[model samples]
Target: MIYLDHNATTPVDPRVVEVMLPLFTDQFANPASKHGPGREVTRIVERARREVATLAGARARDVVFTSGATEAANLAIGGALAAAGPDRPRVLVGATEHPAVLGAADAAAAAAAGPGTRAERIAVHPDGTIDVDDLRRLLGPDVALVAVMAANNETGAVNDLRPLVEPVHSAGALLFSDVTQALGRIPVSLERTGVDVAVASAHKLYGPKGVGALVASGDAWARIAPRAHGGGQERGRRAGTLNTAGIAGFGAAARIAAASMTDDGRRQRTLVAQLTELLVGQLGRGAVELNGPVRARLPNTVNLRFVGAGADDVQACLPQVAVSAGSACSGGGDVPSHVLLAMGRTAAEARESLRFSLGRATTPEEIRTAADQVARAVQRVRSLTQSTPIQDEVRDDNRARTARPAGTPA
Candidate 1:
């Protein structure tokens, strides 16, 4: 099968596996223990922390390991709200944020014991980036946190976070970013961007799954209370036994990504362009519409709407080529993409969209083959549907006027 769904998860690099194997067999002691074996494992965990921190543009002491980005997001959002108390009982999250962030904010607001916190959504532009004006309008002293991701997982649209720092800080709120999709695919400098708290998953960057990090500034940590209480691990911020093997693999992945990210990004960007051009060329421009920004996006990702063709039908036609209709976390639901809906797409338009995310190992040859297969699948699906030619044209025109400007080519 031709796998084009790297956004869901990536294959672990062999080098990362090599780094992890030794830990599981030879050095499996708990990092929290005080024995010599435990001390040795602690060193390994610390080394991984530094590597992850370096990639995230954060200090080593600021990184806290978690099971994955979802857990990290919960810790960040829940902990922040818990610490802020009832006086600052509001969180402003991006409308297109991952379900983890959105759900965390909602759960925090609905907490039974604490003073009620409200979770509001900041609107997004048509191209999927956060609307800073809307964010500014929503900011207030009562707002405790603002969540705007660095890059969108479905559309690959990037946000210019520097423009938001001043406004968020002025309102006495911390800026939190979920960089799970942006960490290795694009440059992410949490400290440089003034993002107080950021979360990333190792699996997104070719490391083992079940390992991720939450990097926060000193002040942000001071405002965050511990969610999990146990043996007082992770500087007392998170409590659990560390995954030594996964942490080592995460470090190896970060080290590799740091050295090759630029080259990898450049190569993947070319492949994505090639694939998109091939699809548009074969399917005709009107039949295909770009779902995200034409620029200021992740190099390895693209989302497109095949006009008049349902994404589920297209996928069913091309079983050999793996792609996603929306966020993998959505569990293959028939529901329309909330990200697209928030960006002004109709339910039908959202269902017609498909996401193609490339990986470091994706090649020009695979791009050509996948493009041919997808084109055939789209044509077959369109023909099978009973819509008339005039209806298709009208739908295509409406999509162009709403989703993309009239002059722009798909």
Candidate 2:
């Protein structure tokens, strides 16, 4: 199968696996313990922490490991709300935020404001980027946090956090970003962007799943309350036993991403352009409409709407090519994508869109094959829609003949 759904998850790199294997075997001791074995394991964990921090341009102590980005997002949103006194009970989240952030903001706000507060949504532009002006109007002293993702998962539209930071800061609100999609594919420095808190997952960067980090600046850490209370791990910020193997793999993945991002991005950008142009060329420009900004988007992602064809039907026709009709987490639901709708697309237009996300392992050969298959699938689905009435007429005529009285049709 040709895999083009890197935004959902990526295959674990073999080098990452090699780094994690040792931890599962010889380095199995708990880092919390103080014995010789434990001390050795603790060093490994700390090193991984530093590597993850380096990937985000944060200090090692500021990085809190969690099960995944979902958990990290929850911790950031909920913790910030709880720490913000009753006076500051509101949260403003991006319209196209992942469910993790949007849901967490609602639940956190409700818990903080006693059913009086609901999370407000910031608007997006027609190109799928967040509207800074909308976000500015929503920011106020009562707002405790403003959650915007560094990059959109479906469209891969990267937001320049510099413009958002000052506005959120001036309002005395913290800026939190979900960098899960941006961490490996682009250059993201949390410190440079002045983002107070950020969350990322390992699996998005070719590392093992079930591992992620919540990186908070020192001031941001002071405002976050611990959600899980147990053995006082993560410097009392988060409480849980560490996933040593997964953390090791995360560190290896971060290191690799840092070293290869420039070259990888350039190559992937070329391939993505090639694939997109091939499809549009084959299907006719009018038949294929690009969903997000032509530039200022992730090099590896392309969301396109196939005119007159439902995304689900097209996907069903091309079983060999793996792509997403929408966010993987939002799949299996019949509704059109919220991201597209927020960007001014009609429900019908949203339903006709598909997202293709390339990755480090994607090859030019695979891209060619996927383009051919996807183009054929879109054409076939459109053809079926156009021919359905004639097909139904033929079936009805056959039935009428079969039901006619014997020898009646002279």
Candidate 3:
């Protein structure tokens, strides 16, 4: 398959896999053990941690390994909220956060127990950028934490977080960014941004799944609380035997992504521009409306609305190419994308949109083929069901049906 869904998850880099293979068996000892074997395992894990820290502009000691971005987000939001002390902690979430942040914020607010300050979502524009005024108005002394994603997983929309950190700090609120989409692909530095806590997953950067990290600024260990309190691993923040092999792979991926940031970004941007031009230029601008800022977006992402098309129908038509109509987390929900709705898309427009993300392995030939296939599929699907009935018609994967062009009904 010609995969175009890097925003969802990426294949593990061969180099990363090679680095991790030996660790799984050769140095399989538990990191907590004091013997030579354990020492070796612990040492390797620390090296991986250092690499991850370096990617985020943090010290090795500040990196706390978790299962993935979801857990890391929970830890960052929950731990920071817990650290906020005495106050009925307030948490702020971006209108376009991944479920990791949205779900974590919900749990954190629920944990507030009393008539405590609750979490609020920052509004966003239809292009997927956050509402700066809404963000400014939301900040206050009672607000304990402000959480915004560095880049949207679905739309490739990049959030300008430098300003976010300052106002958040001015209000005595700590900023926690879900940098899963931004790290490695974009030049993100914890030092320059001044965020208190940031989360990232190795899987998003071509590392093994089930390994991620949370990096915090300053010495806030006293305030940070463990989500899973058990073994003393991760400096008591997370409990369990560390996944040494996965950690090694994460480090390998981080180093590769960090070292090649500029080049990789340029490559992806070129691919995106080419892909988008085909969508609008040849297909007619009315045929496709690309989502998010044309310039300020992740070069790998290209979300488009095939006006009058059911996203699922279009996704199914391109079996050889892997792309997503919505987030993998949404699992083909019939409801319109909340992110799109926040961005100003009517529910109708949101349902008609789909995402195409490029990555390390994507090629020019595959992109051309994928775009052509999508155009043909959209024409075919529109032939069968018109506009409103299309959703019901494409419920099955193999019922031979025809579609006609509706001239990009907006």
Worst-scoring 10-residue span by lDDT in model 2: 385-394
Give the per-residue lDDT digits (tens) of candidate 3, residues 1-410: 88999989999999999999988778889989999999999899999998998898888888889999899888877887777755737888998999878998889878866466578999987678888889999888888888888899989999888878678888877878899999999988887778778889999999999999988876555556777888778778788889999999999999999888889889989988888887676567887887788788997988899877668778767767788877787645477888888888888888789899899888899888888888877876767755445545554433433243456342
Tens digits of lDDT, candidate 2, 1-410: 89999999999999999999989889999999999999998999899999999988888989999999999989999998888877788899999998788888888887776544668999999988899999988888888899999999999998988999889999999999999999988998998889999999999999999999999999999999999999999999989999999999999999999999998899999999999999999999999999989899998999999999888877777757899988887747789999999999999999999999999988999999999999988887777746465334435655787789999963
Q: Tell me each candidate's TM-score.
A: 0.93, 0.93, 0.93
Model 3: residues >4 Å from true position, as ranges? Answer: 387-410
Tell me the whole-model lDDT of each prediction, alpha carbons only. 0.91, 0.90, 0.84
> Which candidate leads in lDDT?
1
True-structure lDDT of candidate 2: 0.90
Q: Return whichever of 1 and 2 wins on lDDT.
A: 1
Summed backbone clashes in each candidate are 0, 0, 8
